[model samples]
Target chain A: MVNSFDVARLAGVSQSTVSRALRGDSKVSERTRTLVADAAKTLGYVPNLAGRALSSGRTNRIGLLVTDLSNEFYHRLIGPVVDRVDEHQHEVVLLADNQSTSDIPNRIISLGLDGVILATTTTDSVIPYKLREKNIPFVYFNRIAPAVPADAAVIDLTDGMQDLVNAIKRNGYKRVGAILGPKNATTGTLRANIFFELLAQNEIFVPFDYRVNGDFSIPAGLEGFQELMSREVPPDVIFCANDVVAMGAINAAHVYDIKVPEDVALVGFDDLPEAKWPIFSLSTVGFDLEKLAAVAVDLLFERIENPEADFKTVELPSYYVTRKSLP
Target chain B: MVNSFDVARLAGVSQSTVSRALRGDSKVSERTRTLVADAAKTLGYVPNLAGRALSSGRTNRIGLLVTDLSNEFYHRLIGPVVDRVDEHQHEVVLLADNQSTSDIPNRIISLGLDGVILATTTTDSVIPYKLREKNIPFVYFNRIAPAVPADAAVIDLTDGMQDLVNAIKRNGYKRVGAILGPKNATTGTLRANIFFELLAQNEIFVPFDYRVNGDFSIPAGLEGFQELMSREVPPDVIFCANDVVAMGAINAAHVYDIKVPEDVALVGFDDLPEAKWPIFSLSTVGFDLEKLAAVAVDLLFERIENPEADFKTVELPSYYVTRKSLP
Candidate 1:
């Protein structure tokens, strides 16, 4: 039951000084901070974050809002985001936007998070607007709500898609099929649009029946691939929205006894770690995952520090990685 | 700017009643709760958890302490844990026990978490002791610190190990090798001990040089497999610490142009989702992951509600899953 008062008495400092030292206030000298830390440790005086948060209106906790926790794509981002947030002496709480949960914005507000990194915002998501209304700072991680002007770290799929399309043309892929991600997600919509535009420009048009739109998930890819393959004349090549989806497509190929590349070439975006596995050897668009995560966290911290600061969108470049999946 | 008072006024209730209704206190009438909720929604009043936490001595925030967020094994557990915690109307904050940062216990206290699900406790870890001293409620998720008696949801490896060893013996494997997990970790040490004992009972002994102890990670599996393979006499069958490590071993096999089961049979514990991938078809020890996560959360909540309750250890059963990895 030792309190800050006990630590202050032991450290021969005032209660306010003890608080300042423990909070790592720059005004407190390093020597004083060390002394206060030692005294606090000796007394087992854990600082009351609730009381401090009440006073300073800062919780030092950020909410990482993700749509699907089961997806491997978000799994890759969590570690990097947590590490970067830790550098700022902040904690990351997972805020799942479960489709069944309708009160996420209220929950986020109730938690009193210092900021949030929105990794699952769809193009028309209402969460961003709700956050803005409440003055809760948030940065879009991989997707953005176009209606809301906010800081975001996104991938530039233009060059990567162009390169992939060119490669497909060079390989003489007669019929192209695609397993697209959710149309509502900018990550899915933007990538699909740019890819189709590039393909059309390259004189290789994908038929309407050749494309399937689903969420960025393995099941989506598996079902989409199955649907496309059921066609009387299936496409010679299938472009998956992301690596997770490509893995699903690969799984579907296994289920259907179809050999990849020889039967139907497959390409995926976001060169996830599994894409490099010898079994997959998947051709994908690669980007610096760590940088993307760092950027998202940095943008969130910036928004937290300066709510009035003009929002900015930073786009990281992506490059195509040719692997055994491509013919 | 909207607060509880405004909602209370609008809902025709006292401020305390509004608070009780919003908090879902059982004493509050159902009609009053609905009225308060509607009023709060109309006014856009989000309850301040910090203020409520200070008065109630509860934050409704639980910490999920994990060692490695990058590993896929933990990935499978995260979603289930989050969902189960959500059912209790509690939020899950991820607390990474980074090796370099030694003030984790203090961080946990500072966060004022209601309870913690320790998913990464080593046998000799000081975290459990610190948590115990502070009277912080915690439940061991998968690993336990034997020194500290607390509620734990762990896997019983006896049946699985016995079955796996019987299979190995039936296959007529003369040589056996293992990539063991860290000796300090109960998950590693316990699994290794049980496997070895069962192997010895079946009259199969693993040579000293045939074992390499490392963390339960892919790199550990990969390096261990490589090291064992480089030996003049490699074991015909290699057992990995866990599925992630087994994947690393598989990767190494590919790197060395060694066909699995043909060149060297392999086995792994923890039948992760990726184990079912056609590329892996990893033979592993399987358990009810969702049940384990739910049980861990339930134990922590029980400890939180009744701190004086007798500590209980719930051991879930594990079973062997045979796949293409085994000869």
Candidate 2:
């Protein structure tokens, strides 16, 4: 309940002096700063956060806009972002970007956010355009808008795809089917292209009907799995776009009374935490998303500090995790 | 980025008038209010959040301090809390309260949080003591301190447990082992007592060796399941401390190649979203956690508005959810 004014009054110092001392401004002598600090500490006096915020014109706060707050993937992403933001003495305000119809940029500006981190922007997203027009400093998270070039932290799925193909070929699997994400998604496009390209190099051809489409949801994966099962002859192995999709496929397999690795092999992308659970233990390719998030946070800070800095895209390497879900 | 000063300058009014007009505060003259508002909209001017925060001495922001940000249960609770907070033109600051042994309250104050919703407090938690001493407004979310008796939203599992007992009896599953959380926890003690009392009513008992204790985590559930399995004859059914613990038990069953319901029945508490997933359709106690969260958010605001308001406790009813996991 105690404010800086109370500390100033107790220390017999002016309010401005208290502010200067607290901020460690060079105008205030070291002795005065120490005295003010001691009194502040003794009284448990904290600066009026509201007043300090007004003076600096910065709340020392950043906006973290995520599309899906409930997604397991997003939850994993939040951990690293929080750590990185906290390290910079900045607090992140979560903005659940519900739909395209939401007035996100305006809300972010109204909140007086120092900067915005677009962790959930899509390729066709108008969020970046609006933010850029407003001159509101923003850094893209995992996904990116090619038309609006900004700093981003992305995974290059190239290496992982190569390994995925090599593994499949060595395991003597030819009939392969893929449960991919939405066609419009950059992650989907990149992942699928890279996967097929690597497969072509290994002389592994995928049938057109073997591909199933999903929207990166568990239900989507389940539907895709059913599509594969309904085939005249189900593929020997099924590759999912992401772990969420894979889990859904496995769940569908259970419902269909199909055994994993015995009847068919399952592989997933994004080695999420649940992938290693004793229940699933799914085999998949994974990168350190936590590190990627930290880098994204740091990138945003860097971009905010140096707006003219060249846009740099950091690509993290991925590796396959061997588990019971795959042979 | 334009502030009240810009709008006031354009509208030929004082900054105070601009603030009153923008906020729709009644003291401002209607003509002046309209002119100020028009200028604000035309110029796309947004109020300096810090300046408004300074004058009001309040930020419409509440903190939800929780442990384990990656948990699915938290995800389910967050949506309702966010909805209620947004209705008050307020935001919930997500704080990961993972450091269980740290000075929780001091850290909260340091963060300059307006108020906190304690979602993971134990009965003997020092956080309540510190907040009470500081006269900081906080409400218990899904957890309560009976000693302090502040505003709380707790789930009464009596009905759920009663139904569970009856179901167990009717199904002819007599031996019931428990995977309980920490002994000092309010939920731990409360649920344990209720379970024992309800079992006594049905004349079904659990021997001392049939119990396994740990934190409310998946590993704890696995360990408890293993411990129970080591007995001369494992219990026919296991009642977990919560949904997550139940999942751990289920995973353990899978690991040991035991079937659910047929070989052993597993029942969880707090029917999380994952509980309904086809992979793990865990039957557990169901309650309106979304509504519970909204109540907790509303309680914090109520306390903020009227600190002298009678400290109240809210208990919500829980019911049994029969699924494939249980007979």
Candidate 3:
């Protein structure tokens, strides 16, 4: 097995120059880098990864921090993120957020991750602060902490919300019901606020009794729909916080023998794959989910490579997809 | 920061002994191990993971290699496997098996995984041989490579098949249509064999045109059901390879305006979470999926610790669940 020393000798460069060239460091002139690369290929030189990592202090492993693995929404993001991370020649280590926020810094240290993607950061989570204090590179994925200024990729729900509200008013839906996500979550809170404000503009109000809060789960959607349906006269339409909740509501409707679009129109956010099934036909807020996931990976890698670069937020746009459930 | 040397000095042992004891090496006596553990705990010494990895050639990172990330069945296993791996003080690295078999050995070598779980190995996959050649620890998860013998955790479909066949016979179903898994996969071949054998015992035959092979996916189920439905005299019942396929068939039924259990009854294997939805009420073969995933992780770690141990296969039992879809 030929080593980088052999390649360096053949290329007429120092071993340190060989290392920098192989790492694609810009400090190494492009011409020298090409010569080193050619020599390495000719010699069949496979760089010792462990030796390189120890020398450079880089793990080449990224951590994806997630709170809920059972959520289809979160798991769906893993595929695209993994694909993107693979392109960067890095492996992904799934880090479950089951431990306390204070334990996160220690966990990251123990795992030896080069960087992390906070996929499920709550607004109040102290993890961002801890990570910043430790100087561990990280980027918020689909969620943001107002107090801890950091890189993020989020969904812009403006156009989607406008389309949804217009459709609801046109459908002659007066009374409304809602199954909102937990108030602590930025995603849930922002979506609920936008939904209610749009409804208010159209002179539609959902009473307190007709609104319920869930933890963005199927069971939550089912129970929330059941609780609202027990009213003297249930609201005509229910806007779910997400597609998972909307699916639950639809399942509940089946159990109650309530006809969708005839008895109650159901709408959801995050047009997940399940939402497009002919059996569901769930009208939903749609965006390029794969692209969002890919962009999050990209932003995290960008931050990792250029730590001094100013933090920025990348907001992906969303639109409404009309389906049988809404019509 | 307390290093291993501090713990070794306090425990009255060599630093090498301290490291081996912390790794739970059989060479270290139980008393010595306990002393080292206690000393390390008292000093609050978090072992330097990267340093240990380099010295011991053990990264404590397990790889889960999957072929398709879009499949819900594969994603669902991540939670339980992650939980089990956490108990063993190892982190999981998600590796996609999208590249050719020739590229797998290099991919594994580059990732620097301590061990791997082959979650989606096809019968023809050469991954097991490559892993063996590399001397990397691995265990088959819910799949088997007959060409390469190894440890595996699989579901026993016997009891479930008996119950399903009995139900079909009792319901007076003569004509049957089926969606079987891929011919190259052990899971698909085994399931199809058992199903057809039992049906033959009762003198019920599924004609070739009424039978189709799928990759155990929703789209496969939809297309298979559609092909059978176009028959001049369609089969009264359709059995899907798995719940995902069953869901697709159910969705296609909705699209074609065909009533489930009235126009046609549908049954599936692998009672996934979506099968229990009131809207689907899919009757499926049920088993302890979490336990199977947990056992796979256990087997992998067991092999890692005792590489010389004889390879064994663990089979979890399954039963048929009766739901509205079957009736």
TM-score winner, 2 or 3:
3
Residue A137 in model 1: lDDT: 93
Candidate 1 vs candidate 2: the lDDT winner is 1
- Model 1 lDDT, residue B73, Cα: 85
* Residue-by-residue lDDT tens digits, candidate 3, B1-327: 688999999999999999999877789999999999899879977676788889988898999988787887877888888888887878898887773322556678656788999987478887889889778889998878877788999988899999999989988887799988888878877887899998999999888888888887889988999988899999899989889889999999999999998889999988888889998999988789899989999999889888999998999998999999896
lDDT of 1 by residue, A80-156 (tens): 88888887878888877873553788889888899999999377678988999889999988877778889999998
Q: Clash totals for all models, in order?
A: 0, 1, 0
- Which numbered prediction scores highest in DockQ against the true structure? 1
Show model 2 residue runs off by greater than 4 Å. A1-40, A99-102, B1-43, B99-103
Per-residue CA lDDT of candidate 3, range A168-250, in tens?
A: 99999987899998888998889888888988988887788888999888999899989888889988889998999999999
Classified by CAPRI criteria, candidate 2 counts as: acceptable
**Second chain of candidate 1: TM-score?**
0.94
Question: What's the iRMSD of model 3?
Answer: 3.1
Per-residue CA lDDT of candidate 1, range B96-179, in tens? 787355378988988889999999846777888998988999999887787888999999988898889988988999899999
In the order shown, the candidates' Cα RMSDs to the true structure are 2.6, 3.6, 3.0
Better of 2 and 3 by lDDT: 3
The positional error of residue A202 in candidate 2, measured at the CA in angstroms, is 2.2
